[model samples]
Target: MREALCQMIERLVREEPGNRFPGEGGPYFTEPLIGFAAADDPLFTQYQTVIGPFHLTPTELAQHETPPWQPATVICWALPISEETRRSNRTETIYPSRAWALTRQHGEAFNSALRRQVVQFLVDAGYQAFAPQLHPAWREYPDSPVGIASSWSERHAAYAAGLGTFSLNDALITPRGIAHRLGSVVTDLAIEPSARPWRDHRSNCLWYREGSCGACIGRCPVGALSKEGHDKAICRGYVYGAVPEAVGAEYGVTSTGCGLCQTKVPCEGRIPAGKVSPLAVKPPEGESPSP
Candidate 1:
């Protein structure tokens, strides 16, 4: 079943025009591996441990098979490449204007179609289909005991799934090494998870994996990411004050977030060869604010 599912994912990726890597990337690639999940997998515990304060909605009790039912099935890891992925080309134009440009370029129509195809494939094969729930990371309120929206860090998931580990800049390092946008999907149907987690490989990149790259720490105009790590308070202060306009300029809109670490990290040079397509970002004056 796992092998078949993996094959199906590869097929969907290859055929979906929208799935094409940014440029005319020849083909979408998949690792020669799959991950399995048991209800009791230690990975879940590890996920919580690594992420610190976050929550997972109760998937077990939330199952309602009635209409409008959208139960999650598989935990998928997705990497979306943005302008930050390419450092060799440092022109401001190199970065994508939007965070979800890769997914949005295909249009909702194509994304829906592709999702349906994959979901149907899973269901027909007797596996329940599911979608990823973005775990809580940044919210306006303090952390709560109840399951919050945020899950473990995307980087942590990749690392736990054995895709890669955390860099000093706090990015996950995959063989591709570049920080493509990443997401996951959790489902009800059980399957064998990957035996060799990304942690085993470890990132060879000096910036993220090796903890050497601190460019982002200094580049943060507001000092959100500092020598000690992310200073949420300092960052938020700017978001709510005089720098609000500048924040919007950097990130696209006036939101209380930043990506200084993500953009200036080491993996910028390690974009995967699998991604051959050219990404498009809006032309900007110099640098944009972080999200």
Candidate 2:
């Protein structure tokens, strides 16, 4: 069942037409990395406290099925941004490149479709399944006391599934790197859980691990990152505020989010194994930062 499911995901991404970028830039996401966790993992409950008391566990959400079915597994995937798109965004100073913005828009529509497709696949296989992020009861709390948070966090699910760890900039540092989209599904399929390889949530992060390589801090155009870590509200305000009004409006970008910190940094393409990459930020000469 696990092998078949992984093949299904691989084929879906390989054959899905919706995975491409606008204007002939090719695929929006490379092949995704899949992982799984037991639905009853204790970490799910832990998220409720860390994210909020209202967060739902996979078993909790699965119980809402008509028969109050309990899920046995949580399947997760990381859709790494394509090399072309990441390269386009790497040189960006103020606005995300057109490729990046449109991908954030249309590419996410593809991600939503992928979620629906995964759910459908599990259902067709005679199992109960649903994407937590797509559930009607799912909710977001941009103004939460913890700063921008949600009732269910995909990043957290990815972490539990052993796909990645949290970074100082508050992004997941997956094996495929930080510039990626994450999604998950809860299902009755009884698949064995993947291994959690790290010692803790911040293990993959360069800053938190060795106390060096803070390149991502300077990559934030808005200074939303620092040694103290990310200011989620400030980051949110800029991505949801100035970005849309600026490049998104004039440059034909769809709704936009700035991920400059995710590119041209040490952890951009891979985990920095005990040493920072030479790709750490250094702007082109005389280029002024966005205001």
Candidate 3:
């Protein structure tokens, strides 16, 4: 069943634009059932210890924190960075070939299409889906917890969904590789979730091992990411500062801003590098691929 579902997801994503990244692409799909019931539950507190801390910190806006009680599932649909996007943005030049770049021109549109498709898929599958940002930061707003902002990190959703583990630079990497955009839907429905793949740090990609590779940490124009982890101030400042220039120049308009991280990881290109896609999933039964 897992392989069947994996094949279906991989096929759909391979046919889409801007999903392939650098190394390989997975039709990797996860249903994080645990997150869905995490709100107000002690059972999940221990789960957090296992999965690692949620990215929210005290410095973040009150509306952006992950709610202690909002138990939701995440579905990730990703692609590779395109050569044209890379050339246009000089991502290859900037990162020195560690990551792949997607043409900024198509990045936003492509991401939107993927997000919509995922939401639609969830609805069709009999689950309630929301952008997370649309919901209140928490059930109580007067004295919300730290980093309790309205916009939750899709990255957390990706992580909880078992898409990948965190790198020193704070980016998630799949078995396929890193450099992907993530979108998620929080739902109350109980669905089967993806099994945890990485037992510990040992199973993660080798580039993460200290001193072995620092493409992500070193590539940052600002020294935001490091051996300790991401410096949120440095990261926010750089990304926020870059957005105006990127928008003025009509570069990729992903709300998350500059994709320098995506450009530096050596993975399969977002689009298929070869004639075949590494992880294209076939449609279920007689159903055809969604447009």
Candidate 4:
């Protein structure tokens, strides 16, 4: 099932034209990395404190369809932005590049469609599946201390699924780095949970570990980031305010995005080498590092 899901994502990115850059003519996302977690994983409960009490559990979500007795699995994935998009955003100091703005808008359209496709696939396979983000009950509390937090955080789900860890910018730093988007589906499929290689949630981030790389802090033109961490309100305002307008004027599309912090950093496309904690074990020969 894991192989099948991975193949499906690869095919979707390769075949979906909407995943392509508007005029740059390339896929918005490279191949995605997928992972799984037990729906009842205690981590989900901990997230309630970290995110909010409003966070939904898989069993709660499963009750929306199947009976509560049914077991569930959460499938999460990291969709890394293409090098083209990453490169373009890296060149910008303040706002996102036109290519990135378009990718942010259109790429998300593809992501939404992909979520539906995955859910349908599971349903067709005789399992009850739902994307919490797609649920009518889904909502975001933008005023939360974290800023723009949702009932179902894809980054958190991805972490539970062993996809990645949180970065200084609060972006999920997968093996493919922070230049990526994430998605998830909760289902009664009961797939084995992926192994989380790191012990701590912020283990993969260099800034959180060695405190040596704060490139993302400098990348924020609005000073939304600092040694203390990110100021989500300021960052959100910049991305949702003047940045989109400028990008729209240049690209002829009103798309809001400012990923300057995600690119031109040590963790842009891969885990920063030599930054892993001393206690972290190297991957066995012939195996790729966890994402």
Number of the candidate with higher TM-score, 1 or 2? 2
Q: In candidate 2, what are the lDDT values of residues 76-195, reduced to their tens digit?
A: 999999999999999998889988898898888889999999999888989889999998778887677688777788888888898877888889988889999888999989999987
Question: Candidate 4 has which clashing residue pairs, if any?
Answer: 163-291
Question: Model 1: runs farther than 4 Å from truth?
Answer: 20-39, 49-54, 57-74, 80-89, 93-117, 134-154, 188-190, 196-211, 232-260, 269-291
Q: Model 1 misses residue 288 by how many Å? A: 34
Please say which candidate is ahead in lDDT: 2 or 4.
2
lDDT for position 18 in model 4: 76
Candidate 4 lDDT by residue in tens digits, 1-291: 767777887899778887886664889898888999999988887777777777777776666663444657899988899998899888888778877887788888899899999989888888778888898768888877556777888888898888877888888888888888788898878788998876467777887777778889999999999988878888888888878766677776677588999999989998886545612475322222111
Cα lDDT for residue 190, candidate 2: 91
Best model per lDDT: 2
Q: Which stretches of candidate 3 lie over 4 Å from their true place?
A: 1-73, 83-106, 124-126, 133-151, 201-211, 250-256, 265-291
Q: Residue 175 lDDT in model 4?
A: 87
Candidates in order, TM-scores: namely: 0.58, 0.92, 0.56, 0.91
Kindly provide the TM-score of model 2 when superposed on the true structure, using C-alpha atoms: 0.92
Each model's lDDT: 0.43, 0.83, 0.43, 0.80
